[model samples]
Target chain A: MKQLGLSVREDAVGNIFGRWVGSEAELGAVATGSHVDAIPFSGKYDGVVGVLGALEAISVLQRSGFQPKRSLEVIMFTSEEPTRFGISCLGSRLMAGSEELVRSLKRTVDNHNVSFVDAADSAGYKIHPDDLHNVFLNQDAYFAFIELHIEQGPILEKEGIPIGIVTAIAAPASIKVEFEGNGGHAGAVLMPARNDAGLAAAELALAVEKYVLESGSIDTVGTVGILQLHPGAINSIPSKSHLEIDVRDIDEKRRNYVIEKVHKSAIDISKIRGVELSEFKIINQDPPALSDKSVINAMEFAAKQLGLEYKLMISRAYHDSLFMAREYHQWV
Target chain B: MKQLGLSVREDAVGNIFGRWVGSEAELGAVATGSHVDAIPFSGKYDGVVGVLGALEAISVLQRSGFQPKRSLEVIMFTSEEPTRFGISCLGSRLMAGSEELVRSLKRTVDNHNVSFVDAADSAGYKIHPDDLHNVFLNQDAYFAFIELHIEQGPILEKEGIPIGIVTAIAAPASIKVEFEGNGGHAGAVLMPARNDAGLAAAELALAVEKYVLESGSIDTVGTVGILQLHPGAINSIPSKSHLEIDVRDIDEKRRNYVIEKVHKSAIDISKIRGVELSEFKIINQDPPALSDKSVINAMEFAAKQLGLEYKLMISRAYHDSLFMAREYHQWV
Candidate 1:
C-alpha cells in the first residue's frame, strides 16, 4: 500500500484496507477485494485470483490517471476457507454482524483445542471476546463492494465462456451425524446378528442422494462429504460411524427441507440397523444473498462494451461476497 | 509355571511353553494351550480364558494325583490379534511352517515403519530373519493338541448349550479396496457432473451385503469393517475412498464365490460412477481347518461322562488352533 501511494489500516479482526482518498472523501467508499486463504490439498487459483486481480485492477486504473469521486478502498478479508476453524467467511461474518458467530466464538475451538481469540492474539491481532463490535462495519460504510473470482465449477469452461456474472449465492447448511452399534469379530459375528455402524453410514449416504434427487430440482445439491468408521480394522466390525453432510440450494426453504429429510433419513437408518443415533448437529444454515440490480446492470454494460460474452448465473458456492451483501446496501 | 513346579521356556518368536514331564517322557507329548494377546479395546475373556483354563486343567489333574504317560505342554502363542503387525496367529503361523510369513517378515513394517525383526528385537526376542526354521514345529512333536476357548459367536449361548465340541474352523478372507474420482466444492459441483468416490464406496459396501445374502447360506457372513473418505471436510467432495471388507464361511468354495462377486461389484460400481479403482488387494485368504474325529469323540465321551450338555459346532473365529491344525497330526 505504501508503494502504491495509498493509506493503509488493519481492523480488529485482521481485515486489511488500503484507501485511495478521492475529492469527496466523506462519502461512502467503493470497496473491492477478496480473501486469500486456501484449503488443504487445494490449488493456488481459488481465492488468489480474486485478491491479486483486484490489486491489478487498481494498479491499472491508477496508471491510466483515473480519478474517483468517492474513496476507493481495497479490503482483504481473512479466513474465507474453513480449513482452520471449520467455518467459512470468519472475517466477513464478523463484519456482517453475525450474532451466531459472536456466540460461537466464545466457545469455538479448533481441532487442536486452540480458541479463535487465542489464535488471533498469537497472530498479533488482539480481540476482546466480550466486545467485538469494533469489527462490525457500519450500515452505510460502503457505497458498493465488488469481487473478481475464477469459476469454481465446470460450467464456464464447458460452455466456452470467458466471463460469468453471479446473480445470487446459494444458501448452504452443514450437518454432522454419528451412529453407534455393537461391533465384534468380523468372522465370528453372523450377518443376521450384526449391527454394523459402517453399513448404517453407507445407507444414509445413499439416502442423501435419494432425498436430493427426489426433490426434483437440479439446483438442489447434497453431498456426503465425509464418512468414517471407528475401530477400522479389517477383521473388526465398525462400532461407530460418522458422516458430515453438505446441503445447498438457491432457495432457502428448499435447502432446509432437504436438510430435514436428511436428518430423518439418518434417524430411520440408525433405527432400522439397530444402531444408535448418537449425534445430529447442524453447524450453520445461512440464507441466500442476492446481487444488487444496479451493480449487475453496471457489470453487464461493461461486459457488453468489451464485447465479452458473459452469462448471468447463480453461484452455488458461497464466498465472502455472500456475507458482505448482508452489511452493504449494494454488492456484486 | 515356576510356582507350579513346571519347566518353562520361551522359543523363537516368543511362544512360551510350560511342560510337565510324565513317566514316559520320550513319548510324543499332549499339547494344550492358546494365545493370550488381545486386540485394542477388547475384553479380558477373549484369549485369557483359554490360557488360564488350560493351566487350571493341569492343576486339577495334578491335585488328583494323575500321572500322564506322555508330557503335557501348555503353549502361549504371540501376537494372535493382528493389532501390531496386521497378521494374526503370528507365532503359530511360523510354527506351522508358513513360508509366506517368513518372506513377509524380511520387509514387513508396522504403521510406525518398524520392521518385524526390529520389533521382535525391541521386545527382547532374537529373530534370525534368514533362519526362521527354528520356529517351525516337528511333525511328531505332539501326539494330540487341544485348545480350550470361549465361544466367540452367539450360537452356543443362544441355543442354551453349556459346552461345544469343535467340528471345523471357518475360512476367512480379507480385502482392501480404494477408489479415486474428481473432487470439487460440494456446492459448486452439480449432481450430474459429480464422480463421487465416497458414493462409490457406499455402493460397494452395500454390494458386499447383497452378495453375501445372495449366496443363500445362513453360514455365509460379510462385513464392510472399515470405510474412509479422503479430504473429508463437510463441503469438499471426496476424491478418494478406502474400504476394508471381511468375508468368511465354513465352506471355502462358497466364501470364495462371495469374494469374487464382491470384486465384480466393486469394478462395476467404479465403472458406473466414473471413478478409478486404484487398489484391490486381498491380504490373506486361508482355508478352513477341520477337527480330528478321534479328538472330537474323546471330547464327546468326556462331556457325556460329566453329564454336561454340549453341541458340535464350527468355530467361526480363527485362533492359533487354525494354524496349529496345519502341522499337528490330530487336533480338537
Candidate 2:
C-alpha cells in the first residue's frame, strides 16, 4: 500500500484498508481485497494470491495512468481462517452486522483457551463489547466488491482452462458428534457384549457419504474430516468416539437437508449400536451467496477485451466474499 | 515370602519366585503364579486377583500343615501387560523359550523410547544378550502349574458359578494398518474426485465386525481398538488414516482365518477407494493354550471335595499362563 501511495487505515477488528482517493471520493468506494490468514499445512496460493494480487492490480492500474471515479480500497480481512478461533471470516462477519456472531465473539475461545476479545486486544484492536456496532458497515458502504483469488479446486486444471470467474460461493455447515459406550479390555470384551463407540462413529461416517450421494448433486459434498477414538490403544476397546463433520453445497436447502439426514442417521446408529449419542452440535451454517449481475457482466467484458478464455464457475470453497456479500449488494 | 520363612529369588528378567522347601527339594516344584502388571484405566482385579489369590492359597496350605514331597512355588511374572514395551507376558514369554521374542527384546522400546534392556537393567535385573537363555525355564522345571485367576468376562458371573476350571486360552493377533490418499480442502474436492483414507479405514472397521460375526462362533471376537486421522481438521480431507486391530479366538485356526479375511477386506477397500495401503503389519500372533487334562481333573477333584460348584470354561483373555503352557506339560 505504501509503495502504491494510497492512504491506509485499519478497522477496530484489524481489517486493514488502503484507499486510492478518486475525483468522486464521497461516493461509495469500489473495494478489491481478500484475507491473508491461512490454515496449517495449506498451500501458499489460497489467500496470499488474493491479497498480493489486489496490490499488484493497483500497481498495474497506476502505471497505466488510470484514475477511478469512486475510491478504490484494498482490504486485508482479519482471521479469515478458523485456525485460531474455530470461526471463519471473523472480520467480514462483524462488518456484515451478524448480531448473533457479534454477541458471541467475546465468549469465543481458541484451543489454547485464549478468549477472542483478549487476543484481538493484545493485537492492538481493543474491542468494546457494548459498542461492537462500530465495526458494522452501513448499507451502500461499497459500490462494488471484487476479490481476485486462485481456484482452490482441480476443475479448471482438468478442463485446461486458464481462468475462472466465480459466479456463486457455496454454503458450508460444520457439525461435531460424539458417541460414548462402555469400554473394556479388547480381549475380554466379546463381540455380542461390546457396545463400541468407534464402530458407531464409523457407521456415521459412512452414513454421511451415503446421505450426500443420495442428494444426487455433484455440487453437494460432505466429509467426516476428523475422527477420534478415546483411550486409543491397541488392546483397549474404545469407550468414546468424536467426529468433526463438514458439509457444503451451492444450494442452501440441499445442504440443510443433507445435514438433517446426517443427524437422523447419527441418532439411528447410536440407538442400534447401543452407544450413547452424547453430543451432536452444529457449529455454523452460513447461506450461499451469488455474484451480482453487473459485476459478472463487467468482469466478462474485461476478459473479452483481453482475449482471455475464462469459465464462469461456482466456488465450492468459500472466502471472505461469502460474508461480505451479506453487507454489500454488488459483491463477487 | 519372608513372613512364610521361604526362599525368595528373582530371575534375570525379574520373575520373582518364592519357594517353600519340602522333604525332597530336588523334585520338580509345583508352581502357581500370575502377573501383577496391568493396563491403564483398568479395574483392580484383572491381574491382581491371581497374584494375591496364589499367596492366599499358600497361606491356607501352610495353615493346614500340608507336607509335600515336591516344593511349592509362587512366581510373580514381570511386564504381563503391553503397557510399556508393546509386548505382553514378557517374562513368561522369555521363560517359555520364545527365542524370536528374546532376540527382539533388546531393541524393543516403550512409548517413551526407553529400550526394554535398559528398563530391565535399571530395575536391578541386568540382562546379558548371549545368556538370555538363563531366563528360560527348563521343560521339567515345574511338576504342575495352576494359576488362580479371576474371570475377566461375564460368563461365570452370569451363571453364578463359584469356581471355573480353565480348559483353554484364546490366541490373539495384533495388526497395524495405515492408508494414505490425496488430501485437499473438503469443500473444494468433489465427491467423485476424493480418495478419502478416513472412509477407507471406516470401511475396514465395519468389515472387521462383519467378518468376525461371520466366523459362526461366540468365542471369536474382533475389535478396531485404535483409529487416527492425520492432520485432522474439520475442513481438511483426511490424507492418512491409521488403525490398530485386535482379533482373538479360542481356536488358533479360526482366529487366523478371521485375520486373513480382515486383511483381504482391507486390501479390497483400499483398492476400491483408490487409497494406498501404506502399511499392513501383523505385529504379533501367538498360538492358543489349552490346560492339561490332569490339571483340570485335579482342580475338579479339589472343588468337589470342598463341595464347591465349578464350571469348566475357556479363557478369552490371554495371560502369563498362556505362554507358561508352552514350556510346561501341565499348566492350568
Candidate 3:
C-alpha cells in the first residue's frame, strides 16, 4: 500500500487512482471512498463533502487508538465532473473495467480539443498501461467499498430525513436534439410560410413537458437544460436550434419511454413546421445500481447503534458505487 | 403661367396649373384635368396618365384647328403622397380652405419643427402668402373642373375590360399596435415560471392572423410587419417584445374590430404569461371619397365616343381624391 506514495497510478487512457495505506498490513483492505473533482463553480458540499467527510471519519477512528483486522484506505479519483476531461466518473468507470465507456469519453466534448493524454499531463497525471491489470488483480482481497454522497434530489428533503441509505442510483441518459430551418427576414415573411427553428424547438420543449405531465409517473423526470439558437435575432427568423435533454428514471423502461416520446415529439414538430430535426443520444444506457443489500443492512445496523434516524431511498444522482457494483457483481 | 416662365404656375405646396389664353381674354376658364402628383409608388397611369393623356387630346384639338368658346386650364395638386409638407392633396385642401386639416398635418408628422413655410424653402421653392391668395382668388371664375383617372383595383381586369370610370374611392383606416413583456434564463426558469415575452408576442401575432381569417370580410386586412424582442438570445427568456400591427379597411367598424381583437389578445397573453404588457396605437382614421356623378358621366361619354371598353369601379387604395372631395365637397 505504501509503494506508490499515495500518488496517482493512471492507465493508458489516463484513468487515475491514488491509494493510502492503513495499519493492518497483512489482511486485505476495506476501501472508503469519494471523488476528488467538482463541477464548475459547484458548491463545496457536492462531491467534496463525501471525500473530506470520509477522511475525517477515518481520522476519528485512528485517533481513538483502534486497529481493525482489515486495513482501511481513502481514494481520490480523477475527473468526475467532465468539466476538465470531458468525462464523468472516468476513474471509477475505468477501475470497474468498463471498456465501452472507457473509449467513449475520449471522443466526447470535441470542441474542447481535449485529448486524453493532454488532459492527464495538464492535470499532472502519468499513465501506466500495466497498472490496469491491478483493477482485476485484487477483487477478493477487498472486504467492501463504501461511498458517501449528498442526495442531489428533493426526495430526502421532502421525506423530512437527515440521512438516507441509497437503495439504487437512478440511471441518467443525456440526449441532444437539434432543429434546423431556413432563416429569413421576419417582416417580409408570412407566418404560414415560415419554418421557424426557434418555434419548432419551443414546441418540442413544451411537448416534453406535456409528456412527462401526462405520464403521471413520479420516477420519470425530464429537463431541457441548454438551448442554443443560431442567428438568434428577434427580427430574424431562427435558422437552427440546439437543446440538451437530461432524462432520468429509477426504472430503465420508464426512462426509455420518456426518451422515445421526446424523439417522436421532435419529429412531429419538425414535420408540422417543415423543419429538419435530428437527435443524438449521448448517453444511451446508464445502468441503475441497486445498493448492496449487505451495505444497506450494515448502514441500518450502524445507525441503530448510533441512535441516528435513517431511511432507505433510491439515489436520483449517479455515483461511483454503481460502476463498482457492476464490476464486482458477486461481491456486491 | 407666364410668371413662372414657360413652365406651369404651381401653388406654394407645388400644385401645378396651366392656363391658355382665349380669343376673349375676359372669359372664364374651364379646368379639364386632375392632379399631376401620384400616390406613393403607384402605377404611372393613376393620376399622371389622365392629366398627360388629356393634354395630348387637347393638342389634337388644337392641331385640328378647333377653338373653344372659353379658355382651358389643366390642374395638378401637390403632396398627394402625404409629403413631408402635409397630408393628402395639401394644395387642393388648402385651396379649398380646409385650414383645420392643414394645421393637423403640420402638427402630426412635422410637429411644427418644419413648418410648411420652412419646408417650401428647403425644397428650393419661394412663394408669398399674397401669391397663394391670388391663386385661389379666381376660383369662382372657373366654368367647371373635371378629372380623369385609371381605376386602381382589379374589378375591371376581372370583368375582362380595359378602362374604368371612377364611381367612389373606399375609405382607409390605418392602425398600428405595439406590445411590450421581462427576460430571464431559460434553463434555471421553467416554462410554467416564465413570463416569456416572445411567446406572448407570438400569441398576439397569431391572434391577428386568426382575426383576419375569421372576420371573412374582403375589405379588411391585417399585417404584423415589425417585431422586436429585447436581448433576444435563445437561452434567454425574452424580457420585452414590440410588435407593429397594421390594419386597414374601407369599413371603419371592421377596422376597429381587428384592432380591438389584437389589443384584447395581447392583454390575454400577458395575463397568461404573468408579464406586464402595454400597447400604442399609431394611426387612426381616413374617410372615403365619392366621385362626382358628373365626372363619371363625362368619363363614360368620352369612352363611348372613343369606342373604348369601360366599367365603373371603386378605388380600393386611398388617394388625394379622398381629401380633395372632403375639402371641396363637390369636386368629385
Please report, in order, the local distance difference test score of every candidate based on alpha carbons.
0.87, 0.88, 0.61
In candidate 1, the residue pairs with backbone N, CA or C atoms under 3 Å apart (3 or more residues apart, or in different chains) clash, namely none
- Provide the TM-score for each candidate, comma-separated: 0.87, 0.84, 0.52
Stretches of candidate 1 off by over 4 Å are A1-25, A55-71, A74-76, A83-85, A107-128, A132-134, A159-162, A297-311, B1-28, B52-71, B83-86, B104-129, B132-134, B155-165, B294-311
- Decide which is better by lDDT, 1 or 2: 2
lDDT of 1 by residue, B1-332 (tens): 76767799887888898999989999888888998878665677888888888898899999999998899988898888776766778899889989888898888888689999999899887888876778888888888889998887788879999999999999988888999999998999999899999999999999999999999998899988778888887778999998878889999999999999999988999899999999998877899999999999999999999999999988888889998899886897
The 10 consecutive residues of candidate 2 chain A with the worst lDDT sum are: A124-133
Best by DockQ: 1
Give fnat for candidate 3: 0.01
Residue A234 of model 2, lDDT score: 75
lDDT digits (tens) for residues A197-309 of candidate 3: 76676666666666765667666655554455655432345677776665667778887887788888888889988999865555545767786678778888999999888
- Sort every candidate by lDDT, greatest first: 2, 1, 3
Please report the candidate that would top TM-score against the real structure: 1
Chain B TM-score of model 1, please? 0.93
**Residues B1-332, model 2: lDDT tens digits:** 77876699988888899999989988889998888877767778877787788888889899999987899998898888876666778889889998888778858887579988788789876788766788888888888888887777778888899898989998988888999999889899999999999999999999999999999998888988889997787888999999989899988899899999999998999899999999998878999988999999998998999999999988888888988888888989
